[model samples]
Target: MRILSFNIQNLRLRQGAGQPRLDGARDRDEIGEASALDPADRRLSAALLAEAKADLVLLQEVFDTDTLDWFNTRLLPAAGLPSYPHAHCPPGNDGRGLDLAVLSRQPVQLTSHANVTPSDLGLEAPQPGLPVFRRDCLMVETGGLTVFTCHFKAPYPDPDTAWPVRRAEADATRRIIERHIPAPSQGLWLIAGDLNEPFEPDAEPAIQPLLPPFSTDLMARLPEDERWTYFDSHSGRYGQPDALLASPALAARWPDAIPQVLRAGLAYEATRHRGAHLQGVGRHRPHASDHAGVLLDLPGI
Candidate 1:
């Protein structure tokens, strides 16, 4: 089975102009020009999903269950997933009304849904009511394979602040996994999503601790030269933040299902605005997403 993970940038109805102002270098640029050439930005995002041909898809930055159902019924059919009878979408803390959703054509058996709470991560303070801090996890089973769909907190530039928050979130994920599959030697357990931590093994102390029980990073399993899952649209640097962590038993069983980070979506160059250019660079619009899709192929055990 082929699984794909993509952080569709909140799946917002509106298309942004140019690049984000966070880069600080483009202060003079209004960034407003990144609006879609066509009115249907959602249609464009849906079209990209169709092209991915993924058997299981973990989509970040979604709205809610209703929107997910609509996308599954209306948009994905064109992408070869005409019917995904199983879907899980939980509301999240993206200020822009975005959330997380998973779509699977592979007859998923609904097992459980765990809300990654601040308390679960050892945070002593009472949780805030804000939806942005809410992270969700869905445990699913299909033909003996266990799949975990997860999305973590976004890491801002302030490492001092963002690091602790994301680390807690990562810890919460580890707790959830431990709660469900104690001894990973049991069966195929996959934790797949936009973990938001850099691919480097020793990048963060918070994220590093989970590596033991979580099996191996799919990207790390590949050769040193071939491991990147995302791109920094603002920085123009290639990186990998999304990840797939599989249990050792699962990896041993479906060795051929080794992770395959799909790069077809990243091959796209920015689409320039019609009849207008920004400082020798095209005004952006109609691109797939800031991050490309990462995939894993798991054969039936």
Candidate 2:
């Protein structure tokens, strides 16, 4: 099976359906509910999905289940995608409502650990009294493998302490894995989603806690230039924030399963000014997502 992870960038539609801003939404109260994507964006995203052809997909920055259902069952299908029979998005701690979600071509049992407190996960609050997950770590049980999909805390612009908070969050996540899959060497597990930081030599490198002993950091094997999943709209800088981490058993068995960072949509010019609908989004952003999709092909159980 091929698994993919993408941070779809706040799946809220533009206001007034095409108003282009948060205030343009049909229901002003739905400000944070709808996706910011226009029809063009949806089509662009669909193309990426079709290109990926993943058996299961882990998503981050989703608004609500209804929106995801609509996209999976309706929007994407209209844009030419086979229906994903199973789609789920449980409410999480993200105040912005950009939660973790999943899409699977196969059946998946859903489990929610959104209520798991910081202390229970061996974490102290960043503010001394707060939830650790910037968004929840959703677990998807696909018979053969248990996939923990997460959107960890983002490093904040203020105070600069979010880096430490993110580290603690990593500890908490590692603990969850240890507790759930006690015998890591024998279990089929994967940690997938937008971890919100990078291991670039120049960066703070906060994600190492989740690697090696706990799981394999698939991105580490890629060349530095191909490691980025996110491209900044303002600065045009590239950084890797999304990852697909495999457990020791899974990684060892599929050591040659290469990881890929698909940036076709972001680099639409490669198609000789084609894909007008997807590429016409304008001066600000690319069509699919700020974060490229990361994928891995796994051995079937």
Candidate 3:
């Protein structure tokens, strides 16, 4: 099974006067005056997905089910890719409607942990009684693999304030996986998503609970210099927020399977990657997303 994990940056469908339009791959704070190249952005996004041709696609920052369905049916076909028969997007905790989504050719069973509070998991929330996850830890079971797809809290406005929340989220995710799988080390499972790890090199990682000994960091298989999957246009910093963490058993089964980081959709401004770009990708606009897509090929899974 070929699986792709991508953070399709704030993919929201808006009801325009003429027809519904999808939001560009830019945040509200980033847009000062330049007109959004939404159509071009989505075109590149679809193009990259078409190129990957993954059997199971795990996506983050999608708006809702309607948006996912529309993109699956409309944009995908236009990009020469068939629409996935199984697509799901459950509402998450994000106020802006950004949610986790999945697209698969095979059947899938999905469960949401959006409302799981700290007390439910016996963990202390940064804020009393609040949910541990900023968005959700979506559990997807398909093709003999139990996939935990998540989008953790970003180290935004204040990294210090966001640390504990992300830590709790990581701890809760580990607990949830252990509770469900019984013996995750022996199970066929993996966690795939944009972890939103902080850019601070000196600070301790909040996502350590999900790392090594518990799950193998598949991205580490790449050369250290090529591990980055996200580019911060603001700070010009490159980070590997996108991850494909596999269970020990799964990683052992496919030790040679290194994830393919698809950067064709990223903007030209992310110059660290000297790879070929998709047609029409500009300096900062007309791009697929701020983060590149990560594809892992697990044959005969």
Candidate 4:
């Protein structure tokens, strides 16, 4: 099975006086005015997904089920890709309505852990009684593979203040995985999503509980220099927030499977990636997303 994980930045569908329109791949904070390239941005986003041709696509930052459905049925076919008959987007904790979504050729069983609080998992909460996950940890089971797709809290305005929340989220995720899979080391599972890890090299990682001895980092199979999947256009900094972490058994089974980071949809401003861009991708506005799509080809379930 070829699985793809992408953070299609803030994909929301809005209805105005005319036909409905999708939001561009930019945050409101980035620009004071609406982008003229909203259509171009979504087209590139669809184009990149078409190119990947993944059987299972895990997405982050989608608005809701309606948005996912419209994109799957309309934009996907318009981009010369077949519609994903099965798509899911459960409401998450994001205040802006940015949610986790999935698109798959085959049917999938999805469960949401959006309301799982730190107290429920026996973990101390950073903000008492609130959900541990910043967004949601969506569990998708398909073709005998269980995938825990997450969109962790970003290390934003203050990494220091954000640390505890992310740490609790990581710890909660670990506990959830442990409860679901009796022996995760022997299970056929993987965690795929934008972890939103801090970019500072020396800073302690909040996602440590989900790394190494617990689950193998599949991105590590690539050369260190090639592991980056996210680009900060403002700071001109590159980071590897997108991850495909596999269970030890799964990683052992596919020892040579390295994820393919598709950057064709990125903007020209992300110059560190001296590669091709999708047609019409401009300096920043007309782009698929700030983050590249990460694809993993697991031949068999």
Q: How close is candidate 3 to the true structure, as a TM-score?
A: 0.97
lDDT value, residue 81 of candidate 3? 100
> 1-301, model 1: which lDDT tens digit per residue?
7788887765533223852211111111434544333323445456557766777788877766766776677656754557588887755555455567778877776543344455544544335322214456667677677777667665655555666666666666666666777776565788777777743433445466456545766677787546666656565566667777788787777666656654443423422112222122222344445565777777654
In lDDT terms, how accurate is model 2? 0.71
lDDT of 4 by residue, 1-301 (tens): 9999999998999998888999989987866645678989999999999999999999999999999999999999999999998999999998788799999999999989999987888887656588778789999999999999999988888888778777788898899999999998999999999888877743568889999999999999999999998888778899998988999999999998989999999989888789888888888768999999999999967
How well does each candidate superpose onto the true structure, as a TM-score? 0.76, 0.84, 0.97, 0.97
| Of 1 and 4, the candidate ranking higher by TM-score | 4
Query: In terms of lDDT, which candidate is strongest?
Result: 3
Clashing pairs in 1: 16-34, 17-33, 17-34, 18-34, 50-79, 62-99, 93-131, 93-132
Off by over 4 Å in 4: 126-128
- Runs in model 1 deviating more than 4 A are 13-31, 38-44, 79-81, 109-133, 199-205, 267-284
lDDT of 4: 0.90
Cα lDDT tens digits, model 3, 221-251, are 9998898999989889999888889999999
